[model samples]
Target: MKNDYLFKGEDICKSFGSTQALKNVTITISRGEIHGLIGENGSGKSTFSSICAGIQKADSGKLYLDGKEYIPSGTVDAMDKGVSMVVQEQGTVGKISASANIFFGKEAMFVKGGVLNVRKMNQEASRVLNDMGITHIDPQVMIDTLTFEDRKLIELARALYTSPKLWIVDETTTALTVNGRDILYSLMNRIKEEGGSVLFISHDIDEIMNMCDALTILRDGVMTATLEKSEFEEDKIKQLMIGREMSGHYYREDTEESIGEEVVLEAQNITGGVLKNVSVSLHRGEILGVGGLSDCGMHDLGRVMFGLTKPDIGKVQKGKGEKVKNAKWAVEHGIAYISKNRDREAMMTLCGIKDNICLPSLKQLAKGGFILKKSERNLSSKWAENMEVKANSVEQFCNTLSGGNKQKVVLAKWLAKGSDIMIMDCPTRGIDIGTKASIYQLIEQLKKEGKSILLISEELPELIGMSDRIVILKDGVLSGEFYRSEGLTEAKLIQKMI
Candidate 1:
């Protein structure tokens, strides 16, 4: 008889300031099993995993690895004890070479007499990439040059290189295309075949159901349920994760009419940086969704429209002749672009919620050329209430809040500005189903209110649900365009994206 347990987390408790990130959490993982951990944003899924991987220490918890007394000091210590994790955010250094990033913190193997062998490190990286069937990336290339999706792959490769007893993947598939997902899914299975365990965390319920042997549902820092594969049901799992019976198609179901006649925003033959001669128009009250593969240039299109990325070929214009020059100009003219990386680009994470919510409309909130503090707070409060943001107070930093709350703040900030056009890029990435549902409702409301929206996302269901019209891009070119109809399906959109 063999012992089934590989690791166990007992009575885990963690906090970040007043926020209880994890509360009395416990879980057991068997060797060779893929265990799924899920929750809404701020539900403490990441926190528990971080404790196990030694990235963050739990305030109170007993961790036993291989039935031993395991207390890892750091990431290296955790890996030494056979636990490795790929975080939700990019885990590689942008300025460093891919080879250096892959071997980061474990470069002692290349050190000989106080000198590092650069050649040997690159050779090893190349070998690993070849073995993994990744040929587009060069080991010598800097990480900054790679796209967001490719950088994620590098991180995945980095973790896989260790061949640890346990692997943790957190919200990675949300950022990937189909090809990227296949690669990751295959790797998790490979680990299982070698009698290793995997801890997979994702907001994609379908993925968790299909890939996991057991599921652990977390809600408000508490373990809600832990069920075996045999007991798995989509409705049951969703109910456990959200603590509610959610009804309705998470996407818009109405055989809806488009909002207005005026073309509010237009991109004429936009050509630059993965976008080649693409043209599109956003009508007032239209929810236009752009879809594509990971590298199909849709990300660039979002940035270009927002004036963050200058177009090499054409111009993005609002109204008749107002040329969008830069981000500042875009904001001044009532255009709000919510980036996919909310923490990185959209939110001022360290600042107070009031500041973030009042930022875009500070000029409007001013009295006689000076922004009144009372007006700012009021504006923030009004929008926060409208968006139903859950926060102790407007004084809390955006970074300290959950993913859903952070997104609400972002929306509140823009809504306060009364922007006519809102460009939402991956608006609900990594958030819980409940949060996703709220966002979809908000998008629908925005369209009905006669605001033009360019909804860009990697998730197919989101495109299918929210978009009045879906534009598909393939390898930096316009591949296909489909309008909202009874016959439109994810398969049709995917056929064009590939």
Candidate 2:
């Protein structure tokens, strides 16, 4: 039997100035099927989706919806034609209530006789949230007060409210917890049962294999291959996406070396909103991994250690015998922090890669009480090459680089400063396997140099594989500690956390 196609794009091409982002790519989505798109950074997954959602127009090609030619000039135009997208970076208004954000662009629905109807909108919003299995958030509460994971759920709920025939979800699950992901998976199943098509994009291939009916692979702005469910394998997918087999050595080999005698950082009796009476010690030449479930206070601990947020009662002692009172003090003490919100906290989007990399190390680049142009350029170019940042040039704007490359730049900036203690919060959050491996190698190199690291991450495997010692935080306190020699496992760590 022949399958019906809900959406089809043939010979689609798009370019940004001289750089071609998509090269004669073709894709088709069938009704009631969840189609997965997999690729490395800058492989056109996001570009193709943007074109489908009407955020950008294809330079050349044809797009057909339900066997009819369709081309939308903007997102509103696409929505009017039963197409909607849930973005990864979040596009909702933070000052408004959750209900208002869901129905923001379609406010006319709540208008009656030239007057707004708040009661009707709230009732409908409650139903929509319930359909997505979200219960903790109130419809009347402002969006800014919600957590990042909750805001992600709201984006999905808003797309569902549109009653779209074609739903595009772009890396939306990265922020969600296990239970939240289950809710989203159930919602996708319901949509499929109603004969709706979904285009799911995620860096996690495991999720794509489990949820998608078929997979499309792109590499270097070209469609590499497409595979059916019967042909799905994690390694095979990785090979296709990167155009080579991955070494599978994500973490450094365990050399079983003892931590140095020197203490790099120490936190005493830290008390914050989600952290209470927290005390931890990090030594030189050590990678300390902090892990726990969502809301377990691990993230808060990182912030307190970095001095991004001052603890109500606590002290951070640095290697220089100086106590850090705030972020400025931390920086002065050779402490560098890479936040989880890379785009918002770690990067300067409008600046060039050279500027971004050299920003954190400006103190060293200045000569005679003025910035040295030649020194800055030499430093940035050297670090960019060493980190393998794939950009046209160091002068290229950071906003134009891919997610993995941007993350590399963020790391480069901190490494350039030669910081003694580094606090990495979700450093590999949205990067691909190849880039993640590079980061792991870099971390190992830093450890070999005797620099201390506090690695705060949500992935259990990463914590177990990389950290010399694993510290589990729960309810604003340290629950358990596991040494690498003791043989740490996810199940045991989780049991301790609960």
Candidate 3:
């Protein structure tokens, strides 16, 4: 690759209502390079990228693109000037079709006077979909009809259509399956081959280490260090970003703990949309990990167990009680479900943190049909503190928090309810290292307290590390079962997953 400078940022600064988001961060990229950006949540990585991509303005910074002073008014202007970003959060409209979402903000291009040319828009969108090897998604189907993974793929297609000189991808792989990731890897390689640049962001250290030629570390909005591929160290990179030594116990090192004999929860011959005669048991004190590829029906198992979906044949029983028939019954019977889609399923985005946290336990917090506000606030505050939720107050809206903070709020809400059985699905999907460590510790602590947990995850290492017992699901059935032994490995679990 040529050593020509592709872009540069000088003294980038930004703030939000007296809170400095980025503190004079600066970095550069060269042609045909995939530069990795890493930082903890609230560390200003997203802020810096948003500024560079023109989604937000920098308070005091100068940027140069191709040796010219680059200034963009908005997202469209930024894309017009050859820069595009796939934001970390969801960026598609549910009510619109996939094709319409792909061509969003540029729909005017297909307008003839006042009339929109639907035929031309669909045709172009179809061509792009074909190019991306996305044959399962219909361009005319509403995005709401698609799954979260498919919708993320649609967003990727939207960015690809821009053909920008610089692509800013922020924590996108967490939403994709293995095949989708391979597609993205190929796309990034193709961009580098064509003399374009990519600024990739992710919480997966291994991904950043393998895919990026150079790495830029950010700590609380400050540029800590930048390292070449030859200089990369897993522990050192994390140390620089968090400004401390993270204990090497990345997972729970304890293997002596064994689960109790009593069965706390059981799925007995449960048959559902994706599950067929699925039977599993969660002991009194155990972290039962369920592992598989994204489409292997493992996630559906969690939903059915939580009563989000009723089985076509059998029942989900809890603690010597009647079968749990619905979500309300499940919650009332001390079962909690932390859904993978937090924004839509877990959090009431428009409500206060206290309201969301106390939502499940309101009946217990009531007196003579009158809701006790004081009790609500106290309970929410207690668990919020326990989870180390970073919010100004319990009155703060859950929607306004960062991704990691949001996940904490969800976990806290469930933990506050004192659920005996918890179904955690991808609990730390896109969060950073420090938060991940805390969550792992929390799971371990909960197990010690005899709170049974069903951890359904796409991450194999997490399954092998955190689980007391793991079951691999393939095509909605049990493929393999493993216990927490020194002999257990990710390769063994993966062998069953496929």
Candidate 4:
């Protein structure tokens, strides 16, 4: 039976400083099946996966691959051992061609006589990308020029280039659109058909149930339960993952539109990127959802509203028609942006939580041209506690925190700033159901407090469940608008999105 397993870990224990991230955890994956690994933030899912992928070493553990002791020195070594992982955050480097990103560390393969064959590398990159059903991205173009979803696909191409026996996808589908997700699902199914295995990690229980043959649930670094497909139950799985029972829907209970007539933020014929002459308005007390496919201009609209990116034509106006000039000006005038690209745009990974949460509110925390440490600490601590950010302390670096916690820190910073208008792009992406529920509740509370929110999301269900009014964009244009009602369904939104 041990020989039947493709990979196995026994008594895995890992710690960072005094924090026990993984505690005597054990798991197994057999050949030719996709296995699900799920847990709340900081529950040791990514920690355990990192150990297997050679990105991190376990403090104490024994790992067996194909019935042999497996110890990988690093990611390259793990690749050599038939293992590769697509990380949670952005893994591709900018200012480089897509082909270079795909063959990043393995450039030696394309070097002949100490000279790199760029064309061969590009050809192989293109082949791998097309093999994985990613056809639109150009291999020769700068990676930064592509959309976030395209870059994610390039990282997937990089992982599949080696044809590893075991592939690990870490919260990757959250970044993708429907088409990109379909491509990934096809690849996972194909791998299983080819007698290979996949370690699929996600915060979405429904996705895990539908995609995996079996799943292991973790809670605070402990393996609470392992359930087969036949034993899969949403409520049971949610309880196991969070160490508590969950009931009812996390979304808003109201079905009627409730909002003020005053426009807090309005985009006046904004045009840039994929957007073309798009205009929209967010009310004073409204969760105005912006939804579309990935390539639609919804994300650009969020950036424009926050003044992070200026529109080529037209302008975004605040209360009483004050034009948003730049991000600094927007922040100064009580506007906050929670970017969909959280790791890159919303956080400084090397900075501590205190710095991250106190950054946007520095002006408020300062007096007599000097900022007091106590003031900063008080502000950061209050918001961090409010957001329930999990860290050893506020001094812990952002990079060391889990995905959901990192997002919490981002939110904490903006909340501490006390902004009245927030442009949130995929705010709950890659977050667990428990945290998502809390965020939904928070959004509703913010609306009650008369804060306007521009909610941009690829999840149609989210828009229908949370928004006072929903706007659908297609090919960079406003295609449809619908008010909150029981008739609002994903099918109705999809009709506009496509």
* Whole-model lDDT values for every prediction: 0.88, 0.87, 0.88, 0.91
RMSD of each: 2.1, 1.7, 2.0, 1.5
Q: What is the TM-score of each predicted model, taking all chains together?
A: 0.95, 0.96, 0.95, 0.97
Name every residue pair that clashes in candidate 3. none
For model 2, the superposed segments whose C-alpha errors exceed 4 Å read: 255-257
- lDDT string for model 1 (345-411, tens) is 9999999999999998878877898989999888888988898887778888887787788999998
Candidate 4: tens digits of C-alpha lDDT, residues 139-167: 99999998878898998888888888899
lDDT (Cα) of model 4: 0.91
Tell me how many clashing residue pairs each candidate has.
0, 0, 0, 0
Misplaced by over 4 Å in model 1 are 1-3, 367-370
Runs of candidate 4 exceeding 4 Å displacement: 1-3
TM-score of 1: 0.95
Pick the lDDT winner: 4
Error of 2 at 327 (Å): 1.0
User: What order do candidates take by TM-score, descending?
Assistant: 4, 2, 3, 1
Better of 1 and 4 by TM-score: 4
